[model samples]
Target: MIEEEPRLSAQEMIDRLEPSLSLKRRVRAVAALLAGLAGAVFVSALWWSEPDPLPGRTQLVFALLTVCCLAWAGYGGWLLTRRVPLFATDRVIAAWMGLAASAATTTALAAVAVQRGTGLVPALAVGGLFVAVALVLAVRAHARRRALLRRVRELTGREEK
Candidate 1:
């Protein structure tokens, strides 16, 4: 025998789910903001430190990474502010873009760290650690967002309706 799914009124759905969605979105936003702040600090360090080999190239890469972080934070914040239903594909697209931006920033940071003449092994190890952590977080966020989109579809009672 097949069981029918319980139907919930729109108000009931909102009441039951809005808080959880809001909390998750807030957490993601905070993470993005913190990442952006970290990038800013990195940029400042590059600017104030004694000249490194190819200082110009290092500075350019650092600046690009910092900008990506800032942009990610701003985009995340805007999504939160707009309350653009998480079911929207735009959320997924933005998340994907943010992931790319984070990876790019991580790569640039590693390059800058290496160019600064730090011991090769230690510099590479630290950079790899940072990249690994960021990758894990990004993957987690992407998975959660995908689950959220699926839930939204289930609730709407439609598959691309």
Candidate 2:
């Protein structure tokens, strides 16, 4: 006779947050490592093998944004590996997203300042705007995730009772 695996209870599932590494964490770690590698490669490319000084404002802007995007992707990976309570997961994710966005914005500002050969004022203003927009998006996504989780809990609770 074939043996069947025993199912864990909801409490057991909740308890598992600390002990076992979830699939999400593993995936995030791998993805983050990849993204970090990619960022390093891009920075190196811009540094070493340049044919000439990039000639125009548009090219500079695009390059700066590309770097920021890569960095943010890596940060998203970091958020994926974190452990948080079911009810608080949305908040935690949003916080991490905001943090990553801020970091990206800072990096972008630095790039802009260096490339433009100008003062910090313009860089800071543009970067700050990018960060603010990212934060707003993160908050909205968190709210949606929280609502979905709440509905799931309600359904599961009904089944148990």
Candidate 3:
């Protein structure tokens, strides 16, 4: 006769585990919400304080970027609030955020160089370095997530796909 192991629900598992996990998740969710609120405020201030008019297309692009940032931040808050396992998605978000930050920094640096009539070579080099670092970190994050997921599957006796 084969013996079957009982499966515990997420809540039951959490209850059986350390209490600190829930506390940490709740704290993280609150922090995320606060950060999102701050970002929204900052964006609102920038939108309200535009001294010079931007071209229509430029304005549209800015608006879209703003929306995307806000949405991502809001989604982070929502995800954390739901008490979902962050290991599944947090690393992916971090990777994309790193890339986005690198692109934004590169653009800003290029813009400043152009305004100052300075050479772009230095800016490009620095931007490239930042992007490379971001990519490396992202790759590491993904690798860690994969390892963690594998460990989880092993502990749960789940078959690998």
Candidate 4:
């Protein structure tokens, strides 16, 4: 027997759905933007304000760090301006980006410690913590995304019939 389409109101539909872009997400997006911009500015200032000329390698490293910060700021801005709500998929992508960033930063710190022949142990310990946290977040994000996808499929399949 054919059933009539269920008339779900807009608010009712929203109430039933999961993962709206909430206030917390907006605040996080803003925080990311501000932090990235501030970091870039601070790094650039340090890079340019040194009394003595820095080595070529140092200059290149500063430039790369600045660019990375700018990229993060751009990502935050994009998130803020997006018309659609960011869902589990976006979270997964962001978590992975964080993991990569943490890994890169740890590697950089480790290299510098080795180069200077000091503080290697502390650097590794701190970096390891960062990497571990990022890995956990990424894994959780993937799991949540998978669960959301499964739920969506189930809901749509039921609705379509």
Candidate number achieving the greatest TM-score relative to the actual structure: 4
* Ranking of predictions according to TM-score: 4, 3, 1, 2
Scored against the true structure, residue 73 in model 1 reaches a CA lDDT of 68
Q: Candidate 2, overall lDDT?
A: 0.60
Q: Write the per-residue lDDT of candidate 2 for residues 59-129, one digit (tens) a residue.
A: 66556555655665665565565565444353455456555757666776676688778778767777778
Give residue 34's lDDT in candidate 4 (0 to 100). Answer: 93
**Residues 39-69 of candidate 4: C-alpha lDDT, one tens digit per residue:** 9999999998986788886887898788778
Where does model 3 exceed 4 Å of error?
1-29, 56-65, 111-116, 159-161
For model 1, the superposed segments whose C-alpha errors exceed 4 Å read 1-7, 18-54, 87-102, 109-118
| Whole-model lDDT values for every prediction | 0.63, 0.60, 0.67, 0.76
* Higher-lDDT candidate of 1 and 2: 1
Q: Give one clash count per candidate, in the order shown.
A: 0, 0, 0, 0
Q: How does residue 89 of candidate 1 score in lDDT?
A: 42
What is the Å distance of residue 138 in model 4 from its true position?
Answer: 0.5
Worst 10 residues of 4 by lDDT: 152-161
Clashing pairs in 1: none
RMSD of 4: 5.3
Provide the RMSD of all predictions against the true structure, rounded to 1 decimal: 6.0, 9.4, 6.1, 5.3
Q: Candidate 2 — worst ten consecutive residues by lDDT sum?
A: 13-22
